[model samples]
Target chain A: MAEEKIRVLIAKPGLDGHDRGAKVVARALRDAGMEVIYTGLRQTPEMIAEAALQEDVDVVGLSILSGAHMALLPKTVQLLREKGLDHVLVVAGGIIPDEDVPKLKEAGIAEVFGPGTSTQTIVEYIRNKVAEIRRSRKNA
Target chain B: MFDKEALEKIKERQEQWEETTLQQWLARLPERDELFRNLSDMPIARLYTPADIPDFDYLEELGFPGEYPFTRGIHATMYRGRLWTMRMFSGYGSAEETNERFKYLLKHGETGLSVAFDTPTLYGYDTDDPMAEGEFGKCGVAVSSLADMEILFDGIPLDKVTTSMTINAPAAILWAMYLVVAEKRGIPWTKIGGTIQNDILKEYIAQKEFVFPPKPSMRLIVDTFEFGAKYVPKWNTISISGYHIREAGATAVQELAFTLYDGFEYVKAGIERGLDVDEFAPRLSFFFNAHNDFFEEIAKFRAARRIWAREMRNRFGAKDPRSWWLRFHTQTAGCTLTAQQPENNIVRVAIQALAAVLGGTQSLHTNSMDEALALPSELAVRIALRTQQIIAHETGVVNTIDPLGGSYYVEYLTRKMEEAAYEYFRKIDAMGGMIAAIEKGFPQKEIADAAYRYQKEIDEKKRIIVGVNEYVSDEPITIPIHKIDPEGERRHRERLARVRRERDNERVRQCLERLRNAAQDERENLMPYILDCVRAYATLGEMMKVLREVFGEYREPIII
Candidate 1:
């Protein structure tokens, strides 16, 4: 039997129209053999969470460059939790300061990637994290 | 450029040098790589000789400065007469805070003003709107109404300085607000000179900041061209831009092609609107990006001038020499800046800014070193401005016009750049111009593919970005980043609320109603109506809402 492909949702969550990073990352994930869905620009947290639920994604990658992550990223995580998708891994990227990375992780982001992060690093992180989550769920 | 006998002899000598002298060196050093490519991934030859540009003519192809085909330059004196305007793109927090920053830039020898509106303002939203949550004053200054505009330009002299506003999507509204500010200051529209980045086609192609769909957007742009030609003769109604396209990961060739093609589209639109080509085309300007590859950037700018001049005179039948001039402003590429070893970006910006000067830009903006992290701190911005000054005053490059005009490689690259851009023009023409190509997701897909390939190259170590992939850094960042005053947003919102409360609501409503009624007529120039709305203190969001109701919003096709 074939292995089950990991499903991921990549979303842009602000008004700033800097989407080069998001589009590149989305294509990278798809090329890595994952089922990737990209939510285009200006998606609110509510819209992102609802898309995450409907798509049944195992991971949600949020890209925000407008310096609104402190307000938008956590709200996206909360909405996902409110929808009872607590097991979904949430990651963030784009122009994020190092100081905000720790706080964002504490706010339920699994990881925060800054500029110049290799797509391979992200692909491997998603693969390992999703596999671990599956193992834990099986044990549960 | 060279006689046939002389060219043959030089070609033979070059071949002999490669076989004997070059072969001996290659046997020892073996070269760095089997292939050498530029930032655009175009291959570079080991050496360029007269054989590369065989058919080059001194007068026909490379005309004198300030003459036809303008390959050397648009002006005869070039930088020897006046240096390129040192315009810095800046804005953050409330109107009051940004106003202070503008004064600081101007005091520090910035020749012109370039306003960078925040994301909400870029999207045509009021500061208090729910859609603007967490976005107020993040990217630039939050200007929701003419009241904010008044404060933003409070003490700045409108007549002395030319301002460039990097606002699109809601560019017309913001421009109206600026004109109203000048009117209240008793300055005539003709005396106030500046540019509105009123290019909307790029919004769909690369920037994606579009509000309405293509047809209405083109109409609005033409409206500005007509209005500005009659009243604000000095104002550049449109700045056809490729900076965002390059930032979105297009190659140097793609940037050159898409930008010039966009210029052609605007000219066509104006002529179709019953305006002569020379009447509005002369006010049209261009904006380009100066990237890491120095020769590639210089070649792109030179080829742009040559192509624009030829096409304007031959294809569009433009009579005035001003219509053929392709005056442009340049900004150093922001995507090339790295978060790691952030100081290295200073060197990168210096090289790029020097390229812009060599390319003969009308104005230039150098990116701050710390921009990869956040908004530019005061220190970083000063360093950026100093980089341009050193290039202008210290370097002797400004002494001569088109110093690199005769180099074999530079001329060859310029010709190749023109050829590649014409190829793209043919393809876009077959696809029925830029709007149709954009709707089909052609340009967007090409940009995405280039972006993905660029990242993969960096990841696979084919490209070595110092301090990123090669010389790694573990040190924590110690540079002071510009932080938005947390109280600035609150104060801005309170000011916006006061403006809404104090302004005459009935007058605002009447103005908006007139605008809505005029928007339905295809013949009516919307700029006058928009000016009335601005005069009445109608908010940016209110004006955009009326247009949205009439024209509807544009939704882009998803392309990954």
Candidate 2:
């Protein structure tokens, strides 16, 4: 039997006010045959996690151009975990410094894609990560 | 400069030359791509000459500087008379810390002040608010009430310094705080010279910092227009900004077309409110991006001035030449600054700043090199300021007036840009003005498409951003990201709490209630009421909350 399509919720968590990357990445993921839901700009971390839980998505991709990732992103991941969504695959993409990538990954993000990370790279990562999550769940 | 017969002869020769010389050159070189487009993705010609502009009437099309069309510049002498204001956007941490940064820039010969508010202030929330958790002093300074604004300009004289606040969603509230500051200094509103980045239209289009819905948000803008015309004559009530639009991944033509359309829509709204064109148009300034392409950027500025002047004079029927002027501030494109090899961005910034000066920007802000890593450090900010000073002092380009004005390439691109903008105008008009089109998600879709295409180009390596997509580096980033001490938020909360505790509670309540009533009335001008709120030391978040209750918050229509 064929597998079900992956669902991803993309959100802009905080007041960065730059949404070009968010919209582009959302479209790229949507075009890749994933069911993508994009919440518009100025979303709080709680809003993102609640949407993620409500939508029951396999992935939560955050796009922030503002340098508030250190504070805002962790809050988002923590909220998701608090809601018992630790099994969800999470990723971040924007103008994050290389140093911050480790910290974000440590904060439960699966991957951090900086500027110039190709859409295809992201699509494949999500597909692979979702497949891994489903396989692990089946084994458990 | 070319007559009809001369132009015709040149055209015939150009046709023959294209058929022969161009064909041979293309067969050998094959050109980069058949598209051959600019950053805005507008097609470019192989070669431009007199033949391209057949009826090129110099007097009518390209007028003298500070003249009717003002195609060359708004000032006759251009930079020779006075250099563009070397203003840098500065803010971080708490109000006191940002104030120190402000003083540092002023001490280093920065000509003007451009305030950058933190996300909470921008979104009209107080620092201590639950919604503002974990987001204090990250991007810019935190100003919750009049007390913070007071501390922000503690040593800086309100009358002497012209501060440009980069607050939009709550611009009226912030501007009122400035007005109250000036009033405290015993200065009349007429004496103050500054700008409120009160351009809500662009917020809906690009910035995404808008609060209320379109109709009420526009009413707030028109209120400022009416209020500024009467009291704050020297102030630029609205800086119709395209910097964010370009930064949002719009092409140069898209930026020009959309920004100008936003400006025109503001004019139409003002006129609909029974205000005369000449009364407020003179004070309507513009803000544009100085992107990487030097020539294209210059052409965009030149084309913008011409379009605005013609529209004001011919379409709006303004008798005052001042009404036709399109004075603008140019900021080096922040998106163009590469995170990899941050030092190389200095060169990029110098080139972009030169383009802005050459294009005759009235004011300029050069982005700091380390901005890609974080908000600029003190050392990085100094280097950025010196970059502008060196251009003004050492570079002799400013000595000449519009040095690139008459170049065949520049003129052709200027004409092409103007035509593209007009085409967009027609589309927008058919869409029943900017607001209607916005609701229908026209401009938003266009910006998204352009952004995607540009990013795709960069990813595919078709477009080369020096340090980003090419000449890659693996060096460790040593640049210091501006650290906001966690104590800043605690202190910010304490100060906001103190302001709430100390201020006259009854007066604040009365002022807020009045504002709420005025907001409900469609005909009421909100500026005065907002000023009353400010004078009573009401917080930005409080006022925004009242307006939200009355006007309702804006939820952007999904474009993708």
Residue B36 in model 1: shift from native, Å? 1.3
**Candidate 2 residue lDDT tens string, B1-560:** 77778887888998898899888988898866767777877677777898777667789878899897888999988888898888899898899999999999999999999999988899899987787766788789999998898899998977788889898889989999989988887889888899999988888889898888998888888999999999999999999999999998888998999999999988999999999999999999999999998899999999999999999988889889999999999999998887788898899999999999989999999999988777898889998999999999998988988888778889888998999999999999999999998899899899999988887888778888777778888887777766667788788889888889999999999999999999889989988899899989899999999998998888889776
Q: Clash pairs of candidate 2?
A: none
Model 2 TM-score relative to the real fold: 0.96
**Highest TM-score scorer:** 1
The 0-to-1 C-alpha lDDT of every candidate, in the order given, reads 0.94, 0.89
Among these predictions, the greatest DockQ belongs to 1
Error of 1 at B408 (Å): 0.4
DockQ (CA atoms), all models: 0.86, 0.62
Which lDDT value does model 2 have at B193? 95
